[model samples]
Target: MINLKISEPNPRESVREYAYRILSENILDLVLVPGAAISEKEISDVLSISRTPVREAFIRLSQEGLLEILPQRGTYVSKIDTEQIAEFKFLRITLEQAVMKLACSDFPQKLQEQLCNCLEKQSICVKKRNHEQFFIFDNMMHDIIFTGCEKSYIWKIIQEANLNYARARVLDLSSRQDEIEVLFAQHKEIVKAIITKDTSLGENIIVRHINKVISDVDDLQKQYPEFFK
Candidate 1:
């Protein structure tokens, strides 16, 4: 049996939107796991919604490269694409390195504090072995940096373009629990560099931080070959 925790639909959300949101969140969070079989009828039955809305949601996720609709074989969650992951990593490294430089020059003090708070939450999540919340706070910290540098739109672009990269990250965190502390330490150093206006340090940290996953891709593939394309 599929173990989906169905959320109540929001008052203003249409059935389709609600279905899409829940399904997408589950996919990104790896609850649906890459390459797992999924069907509109099954999801509709699970969510207690009409098949029409569920079908629509599946089509949308398919367009976003989150679902593979095989003609006769049936639909399944999309596997992680390492090529796309490497592409997005390059894009992120280039743009975020520049953002780090800008942040070092004049990041807002308010945002700086928020980054520290995010780090503290991440620390707690690490201690508790809460990979999900740790991932959330990790993204939140980076979002704060982009907001502080007045480049939030750029951050949004990265988020939208990096879904595959995001899944790869979640996979890494879920599989390699031991690395959480190392990631937390890197985030701390990133915040420190910004606070002290250390552009050189901040830029270097961003590169290393973003490239860590790519460095592990070979090992990750060998360990979970089916999860990757």
Candidate 2:
């Protein structure tokens, strides 16, 4: 049986939106593992809501390639697509490297402080072996960079198209906790590059940091053969 955390909908959020958000988050977090069978009725019952919203949410997720619906079979969480992951990685590296270069030129002081605070928390999470929180802050740090560079919309675009890459990253971090410190160090270098206005260094670190997952794809697929396409 699937166990989903039930929560009240956010203010002004439609039931359909709420369902989509919750289900998509679970799918991304790997709580709803890849290729796991699911159903609209099952999700609706789990969330204590009617099936209509859940069905609508399922449709949206399917459009995003996060859910697969069969005419006679059942709904299943989609497997991570390696080809899509590579494409998204290429998109992210291209856009983010540009953003990092812009950030090095003129990142706001307030955002820079926020990045420092996020890194401090990330450091603590690393010390406590908290890969989950580290992952959260890892994304937060990059978001800050985009926001500082005034490219927030690009960040949103990347995120909207990043489902597979995001899941793959979570898998990588969860399966290989030992690499967390190395990631943390690279993050520090990224921040240092931005603060010191080193555009070349910033670009290099961003590419390397983002590509780290691509480099590990072979091993990840080997370990979790069922999770990928």
Tell me, by TM-score, which candidate is best: 1
lDDT of each: 0.92, 0.91
* lDDT of candidate 1 over 1-229, digit per residue (tens): 5778678989999999999999999999999989999988889889988999999999999999999999989999999999999899889999999999999999888898899899989999999999999999998998999999889999999999988888888889889968798789899999999999999999999999999878888888999899999
Q: Give one digit per residue, the lDDT tens place, for model 2 in 105-155.
A: 999999999999999999999999888789899989988999998899889
lDDT of 2 at 219: 95
lDDT of 2 at 114: 96
Instruction: For each candidate, give its TM-score against the true structure.
Output: 0.97, 0.97
Off by over 4 Å in 2: none
Worst 10 residues of 1 by lDDT: 1-10
What's model 1's TM-score?
0.97
